[model samples]
Target chain A: MEKCKKNRKLIWLTIYNELSSEQKSQLEIHLQACSDCQSDYEEALRLRRALDEKIQVAPTAAQLEASRAELHQRLLLLSQPRLQKSWFDKVWQIVSLDFAPSWRFATAVALLTFGVLIGNFYSRKAATEYNFYQQQISELLESNISNIESVTYDPVTRQVAIELNTLNDFTIQGNIEKPEIQQLLAHSIVVRYQNLSIRKKIPESD
Target chain B: MGNEEELLIRRAQRGNLKAFEDLVKRYDEKIMRLIFNMVSDAEDTRDIYQEVFLKAYQSITNFRFASEFYTWLYRIAVNTCINFRKRKTIVQHDSLDSYLDGNNDNWQILNTSEIRNPEEQLINKELSEQIQKSIDRLPARQKSVFVLKHYHGYKLSEIAVIMNCSEGTVKNYMFRAVQKLKISLQGYQQL
Candidate 1:
């Protein structure tokens, strides 16, 4: 009787084939030994048979065919896009799961082309700027001054002179601490060093 | 699902309307039956049936094939029926007479068992009415569990997935549903 109470749940599960074989075998053994359980089992089977008999509620072929037609109409409407798809939905379709291999390939090629074009444009602009600066410096160094013959500091005159052999030999002499003189001397040396580096980067004409 | 059905589902997931329609034809009958047994009304069943497949169509893209398509589809059907019931006024458990008015074709005997006599036929009708009333009386969750378990013949574990409840909860529901029907039908015999 105590076991019968526990096995009652199994009665329905057994009727439905929801029990494992072990539990089924156990219930089978119990049903053989227990008359009350046997009646319960039989009753459950009768109930299932009756439910099975009465409740074959599946839409008949005609009914199903009708539902399918209606469902198709509704699905047609459902699959139809709104006047417009939400931008996010469009983007998600493109960038996410539904993004096609062809689209991905196109996207990749587009991006790579954009990157190359951007890189090419900026590099050419930068190279042009660098070349322009180089030309100006080389003109200052190679054309404006033939050579620096000497840079002299004279204590008696309290001045510094930078003598050059040029289109015409000239001297720029001023107080050594003068801002203009100090700046010019610094600028010439810096430009000359930069011109040397830029020269190395330029390909030598064959 | 067989490989062919899986192909159909993949196509459907990608928004193939024809493929989705094929899936609908394949599964809608069972879904309609589940709905009919659930709501016990043809119009309501049709509405829920439409809602179920429509929702499946709308949301098929989200289906990751994490589970079988039928289980996922059943979840949609069960929830749609439950929600449709909740949205309408609760018609307290009562006569299925009016509900059965236009639903004659929904009833089919499993074996087409020939009736011996009118008396037996009357008893069978009474038994059928009683069974429907018993179903109508169960709470929504319990009724879903009951339908999925007994009518749909899903194992408790599968029902657990469909119901989105624990297996133990499904078991308890099945037990209660059985007990209710057993009590309700006790007065009738051999119908």
Candidate 2:
């Protein structure tokens, strides 16, 4: 067979009646010229005949009727509302990916839910950070002097001495709601800004 | 398909049970036979028959007028047959002499009832069984190609369309199947 390898396909195609008349003629000429191809062609014919001689069977009329009847019953059942569920159907419904579209929809829903959750977390964090900055800004706008290091209240004198955290150590002693106490705080803020401006000016001078 | 059959399919797609049943009646026998030929078991064939049509029903709405309706249906039927199991029986080894070697082997004897001569009857009956086994032993592609060609009388080109392969591939499958059958049947009866 390997001796006439090209004709192997041609032999089968001819046996199967798939070749055109021109192709059949071409194969015939090759077969006539090549003894190996001739033998192959003859062998292929014998095999085709052997198969043709075999008996063939199909479903019986009775079997067909039973199948059709069964199908009809199933179709009728499909039409009617089902009162009960089989355990397998219930299980399959739960477990089945329910095909591609539903699985994709579930994934989309999950990703959206996840996105909402992440958004919620970051927004809450942003709100907390905003509140923290608001407190700092309010403190700055109101009294300006911050980072009160320590306080000592002298009960007999009715005086509060607050030590301020600044570039230089400083203390203010006054009644809590007194105008003098407010003046000290304002003065401290002015000195702090003055120092900040001087620091910026130094950088430019350098 | 005729106009009426086409119309019936359209109605079936729209969920008309009567139209569907009418359509089923037209092709059910042939479909069942094709399934039976592939599986070679009545019981398995029936189960496949129901599954094929049920699948067709479930997916019919998606069936646009793509090819011939039977081609579409055969695609479903053949795919079900292929997926159902490649070869139901363990492929028999090269040839046993005794015709009734295994009665349990579900090889159907066809057209043997009409044989009057006892000796010829035996050969014919046994030869059919042997041939069927020879066919079953082929690889799935080769088996399907031979079955669709030999049993169903499908042109190789048509089979390519049905099997979703090129005609050249179908012919190659046919050649390989014949070669396998030739080797398998050689040990037993000539046919």
Candidate 3:
């Protein structure tokens, strides 16, 4: 039974004619003595015959010729230097390069740092120009002090009040729409209004 | 390798189109048949057939004569078919009857006068289809192994190289494929 078991496993290879002469002789001896092994061998032979004689499907000559012709045409095209690499090949080429991961990380970091530096420089430059314009507006407002009676600013409303001493002492009160007025108010808020009492005094005077 | 094949490979490597075409003509039939057996679809087989040679031609410059040209070509064929199978959902269809009938030459060769009776012909056709279905049901690796070993008559070692696996693994796949096929075709054994 053990022999039969082993022979049964080799029976398929035997039927397929894959065994060496020694193995074939051994299997033949086993088949002759064991009916079970004989039946298995016969069964395997039947299967092989079925596959070879009946189930064998081959490409027709016409099909083969057509395939060959098509391949020939394609090979002709490929014989020329490829004008374009496939996107996948391009990506693979890039990825297969000798660049190290550390190099990639460094490049990304450098770009990020460069971007941040650029952004910071522009922001600081804009702030400096703003401060310069505010200083000029405050100087201009100081020069026009002869035409003004009193200057009142409301921090909450962001409005400014100018009590003109011309004609009748009327007050001109509106939100600071002019850059000059905004600068003058911004100057007073930043410099002179360091103390809350002084800051509150301007709103109370109105 | 034969001196002729070596000369052909050398010429093909040097951008000799005629040498390349000769090489393709020599192997295209076997390659097409292998692809057809692997995929069991004529259209897909043709596409893979074209792709194999095209890829070989495009990358011929990289061929360093490390192995036989056939082995290298089979590697490309096997890999291409495996990838094609992986990328597409296999829709099993009963087109064997059409395939057999469409190729009357194969039909005549397979069905001689002794088995020409209508009933026996019908039974044989059905049995063949059952066998195909069994083969189709095998997993990809097992199917490739079985097709290469049984259909294409490749050696176990050759299958190993084509599949890029160990000989033991190829044998295991072949065993499993045979077992599955045996079980599947058990009903038609008496015929």
Question: DockQ of every model listed?
Answer: 0.34, 0.34, 0.30
| Alpha-carbon deviation at A5 in model 2, angstroms | 2.0
Off by over 4 Å in 2: A1-3, A81-206, B86-116, B189-191
**Candidate 1 lDDT, tens digit per residue, A15-34?**
88888999999999999999
**Tens-digit per-residue lDDT, A63-153, candidate 2:** 6788899999888887676679789876676455454775767866776898999999999997886566455435544553545565565
Clashes of 3: 0
lDDT of 2 by residue, B1-191 (tens): 68998899999998999998898898888788788777776678888999998888878898888777787888889899888885444522322223233342333345545556768767866777778877766777788888889888889878888888898888888878888888888777443
Alpha carbon deviation, residue B121, candidate 1 (Å): 1.8
- Quote the TM-score that chain A achieves in each candidate: 0.35, 0.38, 0.37
Clashing residue pairs in all predictions, respectively, total 0, 0, 0
Q: Which tens-of-lDDT digit does each residue in B90-133 have in candidate 3?
A: 55443666654654442112345445667877787787677778
- Give the DockQ (C-alpha) for candidate 2: 0.34
Please tell me how candidate 2 rates in CAPRI terms: acceptable
For model 1 chain B, where is the 10-residue window of minimal lDDT?
B92-101
Pairwise DockQ winner, candidates 1 and 3 = 1
- Candidate 3: true contacts recovered, fraction: 0.36
- Scored by TM against the true chain B, the candidates give 0.86, 0.83, 0.87
What is each predicted model's overall lDDT from 0 to 1? 0.76, 0.73, 0.73
When summed lDDT is taken over every stretch of 10 residues in candidate 3 chain B, the lowest stretch is: B105-114
